[model samples]
Target: MGAFETLEPEDPRQVGRYRIVARLGSGGMGQVYLARSPGRRLLAVKVVRPELARDDEFRRRFAREVAAAKRVNGAFTAVVVDADPDGSPAWLATVYVPGVPLNEAVAAHGPWAARSVLALGAGLAEALEAIHAAGVVHRDLKPSNVLLAADGPRVIDFGISAAADASVLTRTGSVIGTPGFMSPEQLVGQPIGPASDVFALGSVLAYVATGVGPFGRGAPHALHYRAVHEQPDLAPLPPEVRDIVAACLAKQPHRRPALAALLDWLTTMDGSNEAPTLRLSEPGWMPDSIARLVREHTSAPLLHTPPPALPGTPPETPRPVPGTPASVRPSAASQPPAEPPGPTVAPEPKAHPAPAPAGEQHEPVPRPSVGETHSAEQRTDPATPSPGHPSGRRPRLSRRLVLLGLSGTALTAATVLIAWETRDSGTPSTDPAPEPGGKSSPDGAPGTRRWSFATGSGVDSSPSVAEGIVYVGSNDGKLYAVDAGTGRQRWAFPTDDHVGSSPTVANGVVYVGSQDTKVYAVDAITGRQRWAFPTTASVYSSPVVADGIVYVGSGVKLYAIEADTGKQRWASSLDGLAASTPMVVGGIVYAGTSFQLCAVDADTGKQRWAFPTSGGASSSAAVAGGVVYVAGWEGKLYAVEADTGKQRWTFSTSGRVYSSPTVADGVVYVGGMDHKLYAVGADTGKPRWTLSAGSEVSSSPTVADGVVYVGSTGGKLYAVKADTGELRWAFSAGAALISSPVVAHGVVYVGSRDKKLYAVYA
Candidate 1:
């Protein structure tokens, strides 16, 4: 809790140029040691795992990220001092903060009062402002990463951070960071920026104010899912702070207030006519209990003797210093002869292992993979619907005329069935049908609908919904746009080869890739080709558009094309074939190849960094909180750093992984050829649950409304609870299902090898 523990025999005596004095703590990556520099300055040296040290790519990335981290300097942040990524064990050193972690402090002394929490928020916001100014994003900003010093809070752990301009280090499609405090975009694998940190700050401040995470504590996946789609529980927060915290927790990153803006808000929390100030140095800023604990921990004896006192200085005494509170006095003997007045230690806190902070470190509760049900008690909030419930609020009736637009008898029959089911239950229907052309329900859940669109060949591309239309591609070389409320095709545009890449609709244009070595931009409404960009080889990587640029990978190169003109902007070479789709965020483009995961500048297509993998990666990358989630064909799922391409952790599946991972809450969901669907931890890569399927599973999972919907090669579409992996229901497609599932309007849409696209109730 104090960042120092007795060094065990197994711990190394030294790492790089530092002598290890004690252990700080262990994370998923490696052990952090409290060590002293050659000059006797305290440092926290994080030694890399042996396996990671042996990885040449990891070592290279580690060095780069360390260099980037060293550039970060701020009052509320621990400064990186040195590192030796090429060392035998590899290590990085940061200024050792002599304070208790926020989690530990909160656990021992209870939640901080409103005034202290406001000060904490202001300091943290300033820290984020500095971090972002350095072009860095502290992806993991949680209570545990914060140190509560006498002066203020210090944010630590750049283990999963990245520079804004640096290449991402994470594997494609992996999620990183603790779940309870992650931002909505991080949970959904969206591009993260400084705004993401603001969201995390909101979560942390909420925890400090309410003693629990804003999203609550439970299965990480559930928490992450809630972060993405549900409103945080601010009911316990004080009225003065609730609105600001709520604004910070907005689902859209752009909606969240900037750090500077947030700092301004925090300064006026007391409703005082004078501007509220963050005075950490002032007495009573921190609660008395926490101050005593800080004093006790810092006053603990040093592992080694301090340098002699200056010649003319009066003999140092264990007395309270002016401006320092009586409850938090410095230890005279622990101070260095020439150093400035600061918190001093007495002796190590009896080597007592502190209790793990709530929601900090605990073995994940393994959930059953098969059928399990949640009772009323399991769902205590009526506002939070139970799993399988389409809407959280009670159902309501909508105008029946909304169904009149059905284009086929099949949809009419399905609507009739829905009416019959509601009537037969003998319970008044409280759920309303979707608005005539809306894609989502009142509660943001997909509405129930039944429709089928048959193509000339199997449809492997997942459906993308826009403007009441569903766009999908098929092996028959055609992109089809079908009515959302019915199964009628609005238009079909033919390509030269199979359309395997999912369509991305933006600005009235549909962008997709084909096996024919071409990327096409077609008008969404007319299905007319707007423009086409040709590559040297097949383009299986889906195109992502940002700022009028289209990023896609084909064969051995990643290309940036003008979205409107289809003219090539730039192209960067890759180590192997581009096997997955490209993700563009924060001016960076991430793509997976047969042999590596690469990041490039979105505008110039200049290579930023690439992390080599043991095998080819066909799984598309998901970027969240400075981590990339990607799977190798060799059965391993990896979480890599986004800025420097450093490997954070990996989870091995029994079979090959071709299905891309979808992250929700704190869980990464993906299917494997081992005929199983797995729920893996986004931060630690630990397994939460696994559900066995009848055959190989190559379909990526989609999570919504607390349910995970995925298809298997065994021709079945499964609906499982996102929190527990419990099977809710299954639908047979009569053929192998290779397409990923999409949920909209309470309907699950997936393609089957039988040449049909089916839409059924979620």
Candidate 2:
């Protein structure tokens, strides 16, 4: 039986004013039923599970939750139409919006292009501002709570964090907040505030663009470890959105810009004036779902009609008939010869001849020799029969000729049948190609191989593709810029040490860091050094540019440098070293180091707030919606509230996760020392899927065009289907590939431990 059925027996068609129409879906605590009110209004009712109803403490907390939810204005949230927390079957009801969840929309529709993303950001920011205006904090702000209503966006399930904020409220011991979505303070059972909600908002934004949440998935322990340490991946986001999201996701509560300010910034964005729309037809999650459907329904083929042949043409050749041999006819020399009726000239046999009886014996026909026939023809007039071979006596009794003719006719029929059967046996081949500006490629075919490129040695760093250029750093101490379309080397900047850091290009400048203890700003067009900033330790962190400042990390300090001058404007010292890069949004810079993640002032690099991690952080941080996701070397993923540095929840991995976390759709993608790639829910931190590779993964990941590209210490790079965590393809190098892959045009580019740069094409 299904889990929901075991918890609540399917019975009474109605509850209170709602008449249950159907069960839309179920979750750990209850079932969500699509129902209609007595007034005939659509609503979604959530009835608590039987087991959870037995908890008196849960009941009391739930009542409080209901009361708090009722206090909020419904304009920015789902209208709480009714509730019966004290009833035999505790339940809550809200107006049902026809639109899908933010997660579902991104998964089914795909990442919103610039406009939609901005509008979404602005709307969510406004919602958060309203929520903050009220006295309550939405501790569990994930993609699920933000529904994409047709009119606008609606935030739901507010104030429930207090009911089962920790595992203590239920027998399952699984908290209410999702691991990747919860803020750092919340994960540690700390007090949550409005800033925490902003953090979650950041995460929501990340998922919309990339399909994954900020922190990756894992068990509770692993998740907690990450919450205490590590940074979320934001490389998959577009340059403009990344800046805003990163700031909102700052680990420090004070560092994050106020929701009111965030809303204004988002509104003024280039695309915010228009509604959000996807540049590509579908988001990263659509292809994965379609692929799953294809595998399940293999019995039926997706067929297409063949295009019309030239103006006038023979109909298509029919398939061969079954049980017929598809081979050439027997030689004419072995067949019986027939006497000429009138003239000596003879006709050639057809390509297909009738088949002879399998076991039948045929009589041989006697005929004049070739020389005799020729002489007879010469002696006769053109149209007259020869005297020796009169029409009445010439070949009237040649049984062999008659039998041979019959056999040839049979052979011809058999040949036709075989052709028909052969064609039927093969897979159907379509003639028309795919349409342009559609889901399919230019040729209209699905699942076509895409192009890939290799840049720099030692792919331990993630790659950034933008403005027609693919930028990446190599262990060989060189940062290379390659053509996004052709994969040809456009420029290579050699550094003093290994370039294990990725590159970020904005405007006309390329920003990258190297182990040489320096961050370089170079001309995107000329590859000339525009400026460089020296650090106290090796620089492995990537760079993020926002407003007029460039945010990066080195050792234990997060620095904000001038975009045009590369001069350090401010620096914040941290408790531990930072390998992960910082995400800049608004005026805040979010980053992690060792066992702590924090937010710094983007303009002055002043410490705003710091949240300690149980383990050190190695992965980069990602911001979206309003949450900050950071993965730790200790095998934990943390979701810290962007504005307050509060812990929302924690999810754990089987092993340490060095690879940065990338967020897309509603899932989080992170590679671990376990050699596994994981997808976790952005709101609940629940496991969606996991895939195993051959070795440890140190390289960060990036999502583009529906594929997740990551490299491992196993010396291989993999392109995985984001939804299913299935490896679509892998490219093996002679040495470990620590560098992440970048996608642009139709190609993916990465560097390996080997000195060579390789390019793979569709």
Candidate 3:
């Protein structure tokens, strides 16, 4: 975390509209204060000191700094949140850099791993790119000026050197430079450009990798002498990054790699002549020791309750800054994907039935044959019929047609599988979801509102949270990574069609299906496409990632795709559309099809067994205690043995069952068009309890902390007592609550027809 100090009596309790809470430190311009906005946002507000405020020239310079800071907006650099230049004491507030500075991190955690150094370089390069594009140069680039946040490294004190007039340094009558990090050109007082930052970046990275400056610490004059005339001590750097750091430390700036090329070089540290994508937000990016320090700052409540009074803590001011500079510090956390607790119900994916594709129109056929067969795409030869079809002569129809004829519909998690529980892997996330039950903010109490993210269209897709980012899809045909806490959009990846499939996060990649018939593997941190596996028809099925393989359904086939490569390992042809999200357990994948619940080999994609059923399988399946629990379009919840595909029990609901089942503590929970959420005995298939939602219950129920969190078409999210089916509370959304509610860290996330994703208390 960035350094913090107790507020002094001299510090203002209020800066403009910001409520000053504590002292950040002293900078050249004046004292820096940490403040909070009414919106609950923590910001760093820089106030001009009385001495500098009286200097008319300093006011102009401070004004320029505010404008310049506002112009340079980058993920790795501070973002100016608000500023007031003409006020009594001109102040500027920017997003806080909450993590520890590079110097402190190195000193505390020893040295970072090679990859961390590379990540730092990439982050710094990106910052430089943004700063230079805004026509500003951050001449003061040093270890103390770089903050290592959970998301990535952040560069601070940018554009301050440019904002300062040379006379200010003369007025101090003392040289002001962090000598170890100062570039040769700046040391010799030669005119500097953007490349000057590159030299400083090299020194910072060298410090991170070796825990010492390349120029060796000494007096400012000796440090400058070594920087301008000596070759940096690069022998200590790991070979993977040594050459690149050497290139950045080139005495002549022209020989250094451009910021653009610097990132390209960072990726190919192995000298393989091939650049592999590196995701900096991966779990292991920062060593466990240092990452814990960052997590503590990031995961803590957004604002620290300001002490009752300014304590005797020392100020964190730099020894000297010639011209006043803004000091802002805000913290961010690493987002870990929702690994839910207890049993979780998977929401039924939405089935699109109207206006079928011209070539894929439906035709009247026997009910059994119509519901249990493959799509026309798989039956390329008209003379041949899919053997999996109950009646070989039955015509092929899209999966949607089967749904319209049998189950009707439910989804945007009443639509996202990676939309629902263990959607992609089918393995239930345990314990983690309930951990936040205690000591959570009142905002997380039953039905309390937190935030909502508006999308281009309804967000039917379920959301996945990981590494401080929330991954969700929208009918808008874009997959958005949003800040789970702030509801701010981080990035959006465009798709050709609606992305109704819920996202599955594994390793450092996010996998999901699109109606466009492609399953994409994306870099979780960067939102860049790593690979796309093409399919034959609309892929309404969400993906389950396991053991380097991505298992998903598209049309009549279950595909085992190489997670890293877009290559298909094998495709298992089903007699009917395998539209349900697949769940893999014990090397066997359990998935529902229009005609039956199919068991396939996880490795070879070979069909292990298929259990025949009437109508079709409309919802995804859940497995627990050696049995698979799946809901049928015919309103039957079937409990079948996972290994043999033999039925153990069947519980019939009042109406069609589109909501997937969640098995926890020997109880199977599911929703139905009958407007009820039911808890059935997993072994006996006997109804334990049922809560009438007052509207159709399409979204699946997620059980955590002895409660069931579910959504209804009536647009309300309900928290019910798991044991007795007692309703604790309900929160109304703007539209249909068709999206299955997902619980993570005491918060419930669900999408709605109102084109928004709501985060409420669980």
> lDDT of all the models against the reference?
0.59, 0.50, 0.59
Please state the error at residue 163 of candidate 3 in Å. Answer: 84
Q: Ten consecutive residues with minimal summed lDDT in candidate 1?
A: 413-422
Task: Provide the TM-score for each candidate, comma-separated.
Answer: 0.46, 0.42, 0.45
Candidate 2 TM-score versus the reference:
0.42
Query: What is the C-alpha local distance difference test score of candidate 3?
Result: 0.59
lDDT of 1 by residue, 1-762 (tens): 432355555677767767776665554346777677778887877777675577776677677777778878888888888888888888878887777777767866777788888888888888888778877888778776787788887887763476666545554212335556778666444578888888889988888888778876422222443576568999999876788889989989899998877888887784332222337655676889988887887786655622334777432222222221111111110010000000000000011111111222111222222342211111011222111100000000000000000000000000000000000112222333323332333343332336667899766565665566777777688888877666677788888766656665556666777756688777766677777778765444555555666666654567777667777888876655543556554677666655567777776777888776554454666555677777775678888897898999999998656666666676777777677889998899999999987666666676666787777666677889888989887776646666666666566777766688777677
Give candidate 1's TM-score.
0.46
Superposed by TM-score, candidate 1 places the C-alpha of residue 2 at a distance from the truth, in angstroms, of 6.1
The deviation in Å at residue 67 for candidate 3 is: 82
- Candidate 3 lDDT over 179-263, as tens digits, reads 5666766644456777888888888888888887786532122244457767899999998778888988999878888888887
By TM-score: ranked, best first = 1, 3, 2
Model 1: number of backbone collisions: 34
Report the lDDT of model 3 for residue 330: 17
Q: Candidate 2 local accuracy as lDDT?
A: 0.50
